[model samples]
Target: MINRILVVCTGNICRSPTAAHLLREALLGCDIAIGSAGLGALIGQPIDGAALATLECHGHRPQLHRARQLTAELAQEADLILTMEQGQVQGVIQRIPEVRGKIFLLGKWQGELEIPDPYRQGPEAFEHSYGLIERAVASWAGRLLLRR
Candidate 1:
């Protein structure tokens, strides 16, 4: 019944966008729609170059993604809201109390791991973030696909 998912991070340029792209690829052939947003986004900005490179290096094609701030409307539309860190769960819920039950850590199933922000850190940080995002996306995809 969960048809739409929103991935969130501190900024949309790095972690969230990367996860959204990977999740979209992993969930191919399924009916779900995936999107990414940031709690403190630099709206209208493109995905960080390093993040894009990391995703491409991992065999996933990066989209022409632009940063968007997390909005109440988006939160209302998403059946599930996955955040990169625990603090984000609080941030989203504080903004949209109706979504309390639906919001969760992106790595909740992966032992509640928190995906770190890799913006401006360098390619290595981006690479590490990508690896974690890939694993989290794969885990969520497997479970979501089973529901179909």
Candidate 2:
């Protein structure tokens, strides 16, 4: 049973938070916990407006998503750490080696694609990023929610 999972990205304001919401909704009946963080977060800021709006369109609005910094302590506690890209996963692995097998790109195991950061990009970029995360998290939930 995967008790906890952490979704990570360059900033918690966008990708990770969106991924966390989808996974949480998909695995609502399970006992697992889902969370997200940023490698270079601006702690306490709300998610960027466009990204939040996109997620809202998908029926998810995270209530209290204060940006969180990536810490070894948090990484060590997670059962699985899913990132948006392989490079980001590598960064986490270097910082918290204990998270080894558990640290992986959210799109890696399945699509082998990278969810590009839509930070400074326009709505189209955010929309594309949202699609990537939604599919990956949905697949993750399916596997994680299986009854043991």
For model 1, how does the per-residue alpha-carbon lDDT over 84-143 read when each residue is reduced to its tens digit? 999999999899999999998889899999988888898888888888888998999899
Model 2 TM-score is 0.94
The CA lDDT at 86 in model 2 is 85
Top TM-score model: 1
Flag regions of model 1 displaced more than 4 Å. Answer: none
Question: lDDT of each model, Cα atoms only?
Answer: 0.90, 0.86
Per-candidate clashes come to 0, 0
Off by over 4 Å in 2: none
Model 2 steric clash pairs: none
In model 1, how large is the Cα lDDT of residue 120? 84
Worst 10 residues of 2 by lDDT: 139-148
Clashing pairs in 1: none
